[model samples]
Each structure stands twice: as structure tokens, then as C-alpha cells.
Target: MVGSFSDIGATSTDFCNFRRDLLAYISGADAQMVVEDMYKNKEMEPDFYFDFDLNEDRELCRFFWADTISRKNYVCFGDVMSFDATYSTNRYKLIFVPFTGVDNHKQSITFGAGLIAREDVESYEWLLKNFKTAMGYTPRCVITDQDPALKVAIPNIMPETRHRFCMWHIMEKVGDKVGNALAQNMEFRKALNNAVWDETLSVTTFELKWAKVMQEYNLVQHRWFDQMYKARASWIPAYFQDIFMGGLLKTTSRSESENSYFGKFTNHHNSLVEFIMQYNRAIGEQRYHQKQLDAKGESSFPETKTPLAIERQAAAMYTKNIFYDFQEEIWEGNFTCKITCKTNDDGGYKYTVHETGGNIFENEGVEEIPGCYIVPRWTKSACAQPMYNVVWKACSNTQGGNELRTIANQLWNEFYNCMGLANGCPTEMDIMLSTMQELKGRLQSARQQTRASTTPQSVIESILNATAPAEIQIKPPSVAKNKGSGKRLKSNKEKATEKGKKKVRTCATCDRPGHDSRNCPERKALPDE
Candidate 1:
């Protein structure tokens, strides 16, 4: 493209420089709204909330923000959040903390984000408080790694919130904290995995299995083992079976998933402004993927495996990805499930489903899905539920009445119906495409006519009043202290196995043989190993 510019009577450097510094200026009192005036535009509480603190020298110190869409997402999926702080996402080494949750699509959705100059209790407290303020309520549950600062801050900030450690984070450390021989032993790994992940077992049974595994592996006296056992209530499913998010994320941690998802658009060398721009891109991509899944759920349906009426109902109710899982359960229940007990209840007859080598379930009815309890959130209709729409309407600026809203919704419905017609009548696609093109041209022509009808003085006023960008006085933050944690500490064997070589690991600070860090070290120290 730069080379082609020469043919168009421009040099490469000229094109590049012009493109780099290009700006559009708007100015004057008429065009600009004061912060106070904007705040007064809404009578209700603001849909967005952002807060930042400055140091004694008036430089950026800590910041947190959540937008309208994110806050709306919180209203729907805010029952659970997976949070962890990451570093090296900006040049000043600010810790990037993202509060992420799972949506109806079973995909990660960000609730809010923060960039803190420090990773201490004070900084985290400020960040969480801002998040709570933005979303209007605390999440019912939160999953996080065992961060020291968060351990102190979250409970103090939101005592009612159910806090738990990520099981995957704990499981990842097994090989690191334990010796290589035990870690490599398939029998030991299996025993430990079964002990931690088997929710079917009772709390006492889980404890017994854990004790047997620890005893067999000679890890009972290990410091790491002891700490894990002490915190079993936080991560172990046997202890928190009633938590709505326990099964969704306890076994497979989304903290790491959120980290990787946001990590794609950020880097250690990014400036504050650069980081914000890229962060927006990351969020746009995240929401775009969710939209694609939503479209797929609406337009497609998977074929049922069995001829069961329940399967057909399930296929209609669930999204494609979750339907596969439901299908597997329905298929397996045919063989593995047996009715062990049936008892009468006020509402209906309650029967106990005894599955082979799994947790027993007390469900209503025998085979009909309508009579049984279903998780509405996992269904295709989850996104369309009127409850969430109420939240959106409350926050929205469009203060239209029910009739106007219905008409607006009908426009979209008709648009989708057209798409369906196009799909159903594939042979007429060429005509349909031509009709759409003609409609687009007509709309553009109408828009141009309306713009041309505007008074020339109005356009002249805008051009005359436009001004250059306002100067910002705030300075960037100094490099600050971060938690310097988050990633699992990989053992020598694990690292070698992953990289396919026995490389010499070294102390990052001293460069004495052992670690690579994305977040650079503040000071030199010996390797913990």
C-alpha cells in the first residue's frame, strides 16, 4: 500500500507520517458538553462507573472501570466470577485484574477490569469496591487463585460472596510442590485426581480417599499437602456442592482462561493508552465470538441420537454446545441410571436416580423432561428470558414504552425472517441479493438527500468552531510493585517435559541456574528450587 502511494503522487514517508498523526478536531462551547451536564442527563444511577486514584505527586496510581454492556452482563451471569491479577500487560508493570464470568453460551465474559499500580491489600480493596459499585451488587460466588492480598481483601470487602480457590491452580502445583517421581507416577496422579475431582463422593468419603492417597504417596507430612488439606473447603466440591458455580468452574478453572484471553492483545511494552485500545479490541473480539455462538444457537439444531421425546425437547431447549453434553447425559442415563427409591412429596412424586459409580440424584418424574427440573440458563431461550431484558431496559437510555419496544423487536424479527426465507429459497438467492443491494442504495440516497437539505450555515458553524484535542495533564504511573504471581510454578521435570529438553533453568535476577518471567523481577533473588 505504501509503494502504491508513490504512483498516486505521494512518497512512502509522507504517507506514513500523515497516516500516523492524522486527527479530527471538534471544538467550541456549543459542541462540547461539560462533565456535570452529562451526569445530569440521566436521572437514574449511571450505567457506567469508573474510578481512579492518584499518588501524592498527582500521577496515575490505580484505576478500575466497567461499561454499560459489562454491567448488564453482570446482571445476567454475575452469579459467579473468576478473578486473577496478571502483570506485564503494560509498560509501567501495572497488574491487570479482570473479573470474568460465564455467559449463557458457556463462554468467558468480562465483568470489569482494573489496572493497579500495586498488588497489595489496599489496591485490591479499591478495585473490588469499584467493581461492586459498577455492577450494583456483589457476585454470589468468586473463584480465584490463592493470592495473598486477595485472601485478605475480598472477605473484608464482600463477606457474603462465596470465595473459593481454583482447583486447576491447586492441581497444577502438585508436581511443582511434590517431587518429580511421585508426580510422574501415573498411579499416584490418578489417585490424587480421583480424590480431588470426584464430587460423587461424600465429604467424609472424599476426606478418606484424600488421606489414603496422601498416606500411600507418603505426602501426609508435606507442607504443601497440609496447606491444601486445610483449604479443602474452598476448592473441593464435596464441601461446596450447593454453590451454583461450583460445578461450572470448580473442576476446570476459568481464571487461567480469562488470563490467556486478555493476554492476546496486551504485552509488557504497551503504554497506558495502547493497553486500553488493545483491551477494547480484546473485548470486542470476545463479544463477537459470543454473538456467533448466539447466531448458531438460533439458526441450527443438532440431530437427536435417540427417539426419546425428552431428547427432542432437549434439542429445542439447549444451545448446540451444551446440548451435546445433555445428549451424553441422557444417553448414559439409559444404561447407567436405575430408580432405587420413589417417595411422595407435596409437589409431586420424588424418585432417587442411582447411577452406577456416581452421585445419586433426587428428581421429579421418571422420563419426561417437562416434569423434571431443568437448568434454564443452559437453554437456547436463556438469552431471550424477560428477566435479563428488564435489567437492560432499566439501564438503557431509550425510555420507550412497551408498544414502541415491541415494534422495535418486530423489526429485528422481520429481518431474521427474511434471512430464513433466503435460506429456505436458495434458488432465489440471486434475486434476494439484488433486492438487498437495491434497498441499501435507496437508503444511502435518502440519507444523502437529508444531509444535503441541512442549512449550509450549520455546517460552516461546525467547521469554524472545531478545535484541536485538549491537552491532558495527568502523567503515567511509575513502575510499581506487583504480586509477581499467578502462573503455576512449574517443576524441573514438568518444564523439561513440556519443552522437550532439560534446559538449565536460572534465577532471573542473578541469571544463575532457574526461571523465565513475563513480569520482570524487581530485584535479583535466588531460585526457590
Candidate 2:
């Protein structure tokens, strides 16, 4: 069990249990009861909010729920959230998505949860819309993975909110997209990570550092690098400095912790009603622990180690655990931060952190254990990227004729992302224009070479040896039974076990019950005589 109970939702189950138990909930009236009970609870406590969607058959297709306490928590700590469908933890195999955030204690807390029959824009849209209704306001920002559906839905649902991607999800893809060798290179990893996570860097400085990393690694021409670079404003911390995402969730992976928390309670073996019971139990444990911490934070005071009012104020403001986090920062601030760009603005002074050169905290052992969880979200610009990768290895002898087309397509897409050119700095524009000119000149020669070296391998117009679908469209034979109208099919073992015992035959002359007619005792005696 996770130490924090309010961290996640449940959705993990094996296939056998899913077919039996999940079907029972979906096809029967039990699923409706769960929603009806939620409604009755909502009526009892007006703060309780629940919404669901039904299919043509009136079966439950999706469910979203946030109780009174959950809504209250949202009012306190719902500025930024991380939510995802954890692996199935219910017998029904519905996707369990928990809307999780960090509380004042810096412990993971859940604002709401949802169960969806499928992962799609419609389901995500419904969940976000209900979340807004329950909370009675849109959050200032939200953090999520680059889920295609979510990328499309969040804007439509909450246009005012800043949607940012989780750095953890993006970093997890590094090994696959950049190849294991480069991904495993510690120097490259650290440089790239430092560039992306440094919230203190200004946008121009970040762009330059990112460009330097690409050049150092000879990844200036890499497709993935270009795509990520153009879209950096969406996910990178430097771009999201205005949003309070780092302030709220800089050190927490609420979704991961939440999954761990709820996993202890909900499992695939649970019936719909049983799962609800377990969910309640888990929430109760979480709330109770949080309350205990709140009491400790309020009643008990830690011994002040210094005369600094900031340190003393932190102790007063934060919970015991969060205060420890603050204390650690206070000790480390000597190396990381500096008062720079200080000037008098209007009636007061404006102090901005130094934004030029390398990040001051880059290599000071300041990066956390889970570097990815601390960052935030996506650009609408990359929403329609082709799902397929045309991996045209240009150096290979096995070149396709359409190789140049793919390259041209990538170039065109990148060029199309230059919507900010009119407002960009003159130096940046000069650099971009010069680079494009050089690329165009080189690409013409490269295209000629690629076309000349193409092999004449004939591509098939159709699947010559296509196979049929794996499953048979057939039904089992029914067994004939005296009592039942529709008996189940009997197996070979059943037939063998249920066969009537060999009938005893009467002897021909003595009418013996134990002997067969062909082997009668009188017949045997006559034959012997």
C-alpha cells in the first residue's frame, strides 16, 4: 500500500475474471445501482458530483465521480493535476483514471476519478467537463502525457487552462526514439535533461542551449530532434515559467503514487459492489492519514536550526514532511540561485533570476530522483503528426525511390511550424534563414544521389497469400437431456463416464441375470457335451 491513500484509482484485472465479472456489471442492473447510489449521495450532500454516459442498450459506458471531500480538496489544491488510466484493477477491466494532485503536505491527493469503457476524446472530454463542474472553476494549468485524445480534448473543454506534458512520459520515450546508444550516453542524457527541466532559463537561452545540445550530438538533422525542438514550448519547463505547475507538482508523480496507493485495495477479482466498497475503504485510509499529518503540522513545531525568518516561516506554513523539503532547499539555495537582473520598476523593484549561460543548478546534484515527474505539457502544433515513422535509412544500400519524398515532407512540416517568425528576433531569423538555405542546396544534391542509388525491387499490389481469420464461426453441439429444455454440450469425458454399464444378460437355459446370451452356461455345457 502507498503511504498516501488518496494518490490513484484502480484498474487491473485478468482476462478470465473480466469476462465473467465485468460482463455481470455491464449487462446487469448492478452498474446502474452504483450510479443511482452516487446520485442519492449527491442529493444528500450537494457537494457530491457524479456523471456517467450510457450506450444504446442503456448499459454503463463511462462513469465519473467526485465526492464532497474530493470537491473540497479540489478547491484547495486543484490548480494543476496529473491523471491517467492506470492498469486495470477491477474485474470489469474498465480504465481507471484518477485526477491526482499535491496537497499542502506535498503528499499525493486525488481530486476525482473515472471509469471508461474505452479511451477516446469523448470520454476524456466528458471527464474534464464534469471535473470543471464539480470544482466550479477551471484550473490555471494541467499536466498530462501527450495522449492524442487529451491533446484534442483539453483545449475544447478548458481553453483558459494551460495544458502541459509530463516530462517523465517524454523522457521514458528517449531510449526508443533516439536509439539506445545515444539515450544511454550519460553526458547527452544529462545535458538534454538539464536543458529541458531548468525552469529558470529564459526561452531564448533554452532554445540556444537546446540547439547546442543537438549540434554537439550531431542531431541537428535528426527528425525527432527537430520535431521536439519546434514544439519545446509545450512541454519544456523554461516555456511554462509563467504557469504555477512547478510550484504545485515539481517533486511529485501523483499518478504513479496514486496507482500504488489504490492498487492495495482494488483488484480484478472484485465485483462491482465489492470494488466500490474497497475504493471507499482506501479513500478513508488516505483521508485519515492526511488528517493526522495536518494535526501534526498544526500542533507540533520543529526545533529551529537557524535565525532566518524565512526558515521559521516555512516551518509554520508547511506540513512536517513538506517543511523538510523546504529545509533542504534552504540549505541548497547557496549553490543554485542568485539575485540577478535587479532593477527598480515603477514604484517597486523587479528582480529576475539570471537567464543567460548554462543553468546554475545543472550539475550540483540538484536533479531529483525521478527527474521526469517534476516537469509539465503539449503543443496543438504537433496534434496531427503521422502515427507512422518512415524510417528511411539514407546510408543503407537498400534505398526506396520515395525516400526523398519523406525527407521533403519532414522539411515542409518543420517549415510550416514557423508561425512565430514575424515576431522572432532578427538574429534568430538570420540563423534560421541561413540554415534553410544551406539545407536546400545540400538536399538537391542528396536527392539526386538517393534517386540514382535506388534498387528496382517490385512492390506487391496485393497480399498474394492472405490467410483467413483465426477463429472459427461455429457453435458447439447441444447434448440431449431428459429433464432440461436446453442442455449444455457434453464432452468426450462426460460421454465415457456416463455410458450405461454393460447390461447383464440372462443365460439361455437357466435365465441367469449375470451371463450374456451368447455365453450362457447351458449353451456352454451343450457345446462341451
Candidate 3:
């Protein structure tokens, strides 16, 4: 027989009893009812807006929240957002949807939150619409996992917004989707990585590398590759690297982390009231941390790398965290990089930036591949002189070939322009042009000096490899629009091939040939054993 609560606390069965009590409380309570009460309470508070949906049976289907602070943060830092519906919280199995943004301290801040009963398009649409309604503005860019429903809903709701698929999520799936043979192939992996991650490569360069990789691996017919290629613009950074994303998030990783952070306070076993209370506590702590960062940002000044006006300006303008990042760029731009004219005549100069730090590729414990592969020098062509506004082509590929292509473009104005060309010097326009001409002259002199010694046998080989075309010109495809037809009708052979190809599901847990890990029978015994 169990005694009073005080006596139970001293016993060995305390934890078990506590868990049992929590379970009992959760089972007895109505989650929807508790949430409704919370809604009513928050309604009384200033600037706290929440909405919910119910099914025909009056069951809670969805819930959304945006408090006073959340709305304020959204207005300031709402330009970029990372929305994810991956986490399932509460015993009710509600899909936790969070619209997260970056704050001043570079911390993940929740702009709004939603809970949905289903992962369908309708549920997502409702959630997104509610978020839009509450915030009164659409985010410029939205990053999320590659969910079909979300892919549909985002554009429907916020048509102007750039919807980016999380590169991290796409890259994470690569190892599992590609077989061991391809995964083990070092050259293939490198090519694939370059194809996916190298934003520095122009579209032409990417196409070249991609074709080479796919042909070598015979992966042109692969379903995953086909789907990913078709959806390249959604996930690939090379497609839209120019857009500003508030540096908040490039992936849904922050949202995932926020989910885990919220998990520390509440559990699935928690009662509705308990869950709400814990959620408030978690949110309170998060906001408090933000406030602390705000105070720190406002009160302090960061030390500059050099006594440049731009560096000082950045230090004064941006918050501490962002200023540090700017400072890093300042230092890197000034010391580690150099500009040389690749080609220059009358029709503007083509300058290539030479950087000491190139792309570094390594396989950690994979002995089959080399320990390290370092691309010591990578170059980007800058079209036109600095005075006339420089347009830099994609730099050489990144060291760690991940899918996010970072294109560093500096516009002609303020410190940004200064750092790129003059190393933070406020020079007159004529002087800058003269400096460019002198640099071009120097490059021509250097190239002439190094041409004979540097022109390897490979250049001669490449020249020999180019076969002169015979007097034959293939007829181009018909450009005239066929009446009553916008679609290209596929032949029977293509249809048959499509029908023959069946998509396979691999078990993540057991690594089995068939079946998903979620439905794997081996999961139960496999974990313990």
C-alpha cells in the first residue's frame, strides 16, 4: 500500500510512481480543452494572437501562436525564415511547426509556432496562412525540408518568396540513397560534391561536372538524381545565391535544434496544462536570453582587426555577433586574397581573384580514398574595372563541396565596395581606374614571363584533343510552335521504360534491401540486442 505523497518521495518507487501519475494525468485530461483555455488567457494579454481549427467532430486539428515579442521580432528579422514540420511533440502526436528566424545575437528566434494533427497540404496551408495573417508580411526567403505538401503550399501562399529546400537535408540523404559502390568511389563522390555544392562554378561549369560525374557513375537513369536535378532550383544554392537570407538560417537545422530545446522542458507524457506551462517557461527563457544578447549588443563595442573606417562603421552599425562576421570578411579580403586580370583589352577587363585558401576535401576515416585533397588555388573572374562596377563570375568551387554555393559579390558603394577592391581605402574614382589599368599591365607582364614555363604538355594535349568538325551541320530541332500543343508527347518506349522502373524503399534502421525503418520488425529487438 502506497502512503501519503511525502512518504512516497522517500521510496525507491518514486520515479516509477511519478511517471505513472503523469501518464494517468495525461490520459485523464483533455488536451484540446486545455489549449482552448490557454487561447482564452492569451487573448486577454496584449498583442497575443492565436488561432485554431476543428474538424466536423469538433476535434482540434490545428493551432497557431504568435505573442507580442514574436510579432516584434518578425517585423525586424522576418526577411528570412526557416519553417519545418518534422518534429512530432505531445502524446497526441501533433506535428510541431515552427517558423524560426535569426535574431541580433545570431540565435534562432521563433517568429511563430503551429501544431497540426496531419501532415497534409490543407493543414500546412492553414498554418502558413495564419502565420501570414498574424505577421502581416511575408518572408523574403523560406527554407524548409523537401516536403511535397510544403512545396505546394509555400508558393500558393507567398508567391513572391523564394522557397529554398534545405541543402543539409538533401545532402544528408545522399549517403543512404546512393549505394556503397558509388559512396566508396572517391572521384565520383568528389564530382558529385562539386556538382551539388560548388556555387563558384557557373551553370556551364556545373553542367560539365554533373554530366561527367553522372556519365562516369552511370547514374543518369537513377530516380533520386532525376528528381533532384528537376528540383535543383529549390535546393541548390547555385540557383539563387544572390538573395539575402538575413544570415539567420540556410537549413531547418536551427528549427530542429529549437524543437530539441523545447523538448527539454516538456515531454509527451506531460498533461495539456503541464505542457502549456512548460512551453511558456521554455519560451520565456528563450526571450530572456535574447534580451540578454540585446543588452550586450547595445552596450559593448567589438575590437576591430584594422583601423579602417569601414571596419569601425560595421562595428558601430551591426550587433556584436554580426560585427565579428564582418570583421572576419574584412581581414580575409585584405590579406588572404589578390586580384589579377585574366584578360584585358578594350572591352573591359576580366580580373580573376587568387586566394591562398582553396577548397580542402578530406575523408575522415575512409582509407580507400586519399587522406587529403587540397585545391590550393581557386579563381573567380571579375568582369569590368572597379570604377565601372565589377561583376564577378562564380569563383572556383568551395573546399568542402556541400550544396550551398556562397557567391561573394561586393557592390560599388560604402565599405562593401572598398573591401572588395581597395582594401577599405576611400579612393577617388580616377585613381581606382588608374590602379586597375596598372594592375592589368602588371598581369600582362607576369603572364608573358610565366607563359612558356607554365604552359604544360596538357595544354598541347587539349589542343590536339579538339577534332576539327567535318562539313556537316545537323538540322536544329523545330522551333515553330505546333498548333493546339504545348506538351511534348513521349514515345511508347519511354513510357514502357518509366513503367518498368520501380522505386525501392530501404529500411534505415536495419539497412535492409526493402521496407522503411519505421515499419521494420527488427527495430524492437535490434535496439536492445
Name the candidate that leads on TM-score: 1
Global Cα RMSD, each model? 10.6, 32.2, 29.3
Reference-based TM-score of each model: 0.69, 0.58, 0.59
Stretches of candidate 2 exceeding 4 Å from the true structure = 1-27, 246-252, 332-529
- Candidate 1 collision pairs: 505-514, 506-514, 507-514
**Which pairs clash (backbone N, Cα, C closer than 3 Å) in model 2?**
7-258, 8-258, 11-87, 11-88, 11-89, 12-88, 12-89, 164-377, 165-376, 165-377
Where in model 1 is the C-alpha error above 4 Å?
1-45, 337-367, 370-372, 383-473, 483-529
CA lDDT of 335 in candidate 1? 94
Candidate 2 structure lDDT? 0.66
Top lDDT model: 1
Q: Candidate 1, residues 1-529: lDDT per residue as tens digits?
A: 4236444655778655542332121122211222222233333335666777778876678887777778777777778788887777976788898888888778888888888888789989999888877777887778887888889999999999988887887888788787777778999999998999887778999999999998987889999899889988888988877767723557435766778877888888665644765887899898989889989888888899898888888888888888888899989878999999998899689999888988799888845576347776677776555224445445544534445768888988987887888886766777878887899889979978988787544554343332232553445577776445345576676667878765677766557644455333635354765
lDDT of each: 0.74, 0.66, 0.66
Worst 10 residues of 1 by lDDT: 23-32
**TM-score of candidate 3 against the unseen true structure:** 0.59
What is candidate 3's lDDT per residue for 446-519, written digit by digit as tens?
97777767643334224222222232122111111221123558655456668779665678887776678777
lDDT of 3 at 388: 21
- The full ranking of all candidates by TM-score, starting with the best, is 1, 3, 2
